[model samples]
Target: MRLTGTLDPVYNLRYVDSVNVSYYNNRLLPGGGRITVSVPVHNNRFSAWVPPLPAGDRLVLRLRYPEMPDSAGRILDVGGVSLMTGDSIVELSIGKGTYNPRLKKFALKADVVTGEQNIARLAYLGAMRLRNNITDTLRKKLYEKTIDSMAYNTAMQKASELRDSIDRDFIIRHPSSLQSLNILETIIGRYLNKQGGWNASGNKRLTEIDNLLQALDRSLRDSEKAQHLITSLDRAREMKLIPFTGIMPDGSVFDVASLEGKVFLIDFWGSWCGWCRKSHPHLKELYEKYKDEGFEIIGIGEEFGTGKEQWDRFRKAIAADGITWPQILNDPARQDVVSDYMVQSFPSKFLIDRNGKVVLRVLGDSEGLLDAKLKELFGK
Candidate 1:
């Protein structure tokens, strides 16, 4: 597939070094795939030969503008711009796309390349429009104090359900498409919460999901990505802890078995999660108070991008937060633990008893559930 594009010089072409074209790979398993190929940009124009993508494959074309200044003059990498793929060649124009610095999101304008690309583009844009409209409405209501926090959350849930219906319709209509499989995976994640638990409606959703998968083309149904999705579904129903090993930030191996026979907490968090970092002080207090009482906390740091910068952020967050617990990093080289846990959100935790059984699993702090449970366990 030949991909050629021109960026509007207004985007400050000097900052953009290349364009990164990322596409779906069903074989990578567990987390789906984000295979990226970088094409160098010169004079605001760039071209590259991308491997042919299977039908229904999702594509995201993004600018590699390091530290590009936003409207607010804040320096940061812009969020990726999703693109529709054509069969042979694609030509895009980065027209007067708007950038919201506060949200760190950018939009792009692409020329009508082919019928396939147009259909995909419309579906993508429709979803985005739905999300943006709902978000804008909610923001207006909140700013005007028309609704309280509880009401806001409830409305957000409804908005999510609305979007899920749209995705469901798309998948049912395009079962054989690879994009259908990708959308199915996302819907599955939403059904399975951060703690690997699902609600009463989950059973029905799972059955429907299975039917959808079977309706897919035989080739896609038999693909590795489909198999991974099936495995995840099974795990959601009969959720059990997966014993694994990980590399610590200090280059040491940490085994889950090491914490056996102790009342411990498995915290899945990332430096980018504000709520996770905010809870550090409380966690520090709990650890220091319960360490001698056979209580332990193992942090599974799920860093974003791999490299010195991300590692540094992880370490810096640890130091700044004064966290002293044993931390296991889930980098590219070691994503097994995170993948095994099926962690969908930050600050997901499992409170295990001395018998190595998960007594309580919660996303976020769970409104002091951790503290109350710990108090009961250790009689603090």
Candidate 2:
């Protein structure tokens, strides 16, 4: 087959990337796959071209629907424009609906929506290039402040702060873009601050002391940070400010406070969520050992597809694959949990003691560390 190519700066780029997917059941090793995204620069519309598969595989895809990234359009807080910021529609020409593998194209047809904000992303990249020499201390401060402010809801603010946080070399490698953790924080932080205030008090004071502390926290909080967001979310749940309930595996429901007297593991996941399943081995081992010690692993299935079919398959997958732990199919994802707890990524876990207080919030590998952690926590 011969492929013809043309350069139409706005509408001619057909790009795709490969992603690694893992089974929640811990039995299958992660596999790599491809996703194609079509961005019509002229119409500002985006479409995804999912790979076609056989019927059985297709069913699995349905049960565990992939979390298609929003082509920078579905960026939760694009440009620091939060749900809280009104009249801030930054007109992103986003096409709705998922890729219909049957049709091998987007399901809802190609069209444009009113609220996509890739502009912030563009501005963020531009600013990064313009001011590539910000000091680390200031950059960190900007990161924290951006997170604190929730500027991710808007494009301009996100672009500004992100520009400050970006590293010069990263862009040099990928000149068309310079994005990652720093960008997420700066944009997301701003959005969160404006929309919901990180599930905690805004700390909006203008005092020097507060500003200094904010700077310090921002500098100190880096790629290694954990629990801050989770802690904030937990605090909000305790206050009963949000009228929300969460769905657990087994198709049950409960609020965070309801599971108070148990040792619980809030596993953040989704059916099409590959990263969450990546930690199955550790989860399995942890459950096997500590389950007898009153350990209850309540997986808060995030994303969509928390139904029985998916849950059962997930459970079976883990069991057949070596995980014999109890799981609650989580619904509404962990809205309060993620927001209050400030969970930003997947496979993140929060260890709760019997009395219902968090012992630790883990962001990285806990598979090998689970046993050691439990022993220390159990004082055995």
| Residue 77, model 2: Cα distance from true site in angstroms | 22
**Model 1 spans with C-alpha error above 4 angstroms:** 4-47, 51-80, 84-108, 115-118, 146-157, 194-202, 288-293, 304-306, 353-359, 372-380
Residue pairs clashing, model 1:
56-178, 56-179
**lDDT by residue (tens digit), candidate 2, 1-380:** 01111221221122212212211211111122233222332222222232332111110111111354445222111122111111123232222344456544443211113322223334544555456444343466557774333433354455555553453233233332213223333333333333212322334422321232233333233223223433343453442222246554445666656656666776766556566677776677667776777777766544433244556666655555454444544333244444444455666666666666555555545554455567777666
lDDT of each: 0.72, 0.40
lDDT of 1 by residue, 107-142 (tens): 455554444544565675678687879978997999
RMSD of candidate 2 to true structure, Å: 15.9
Question: Where in model 2 is the C-alpha error above 4 Å?
Answer: 1-121, 129-250, 254-259, 273-275, 305-324, 333-336
Q: How many clashing residue pairs, candidate 1? A: 2
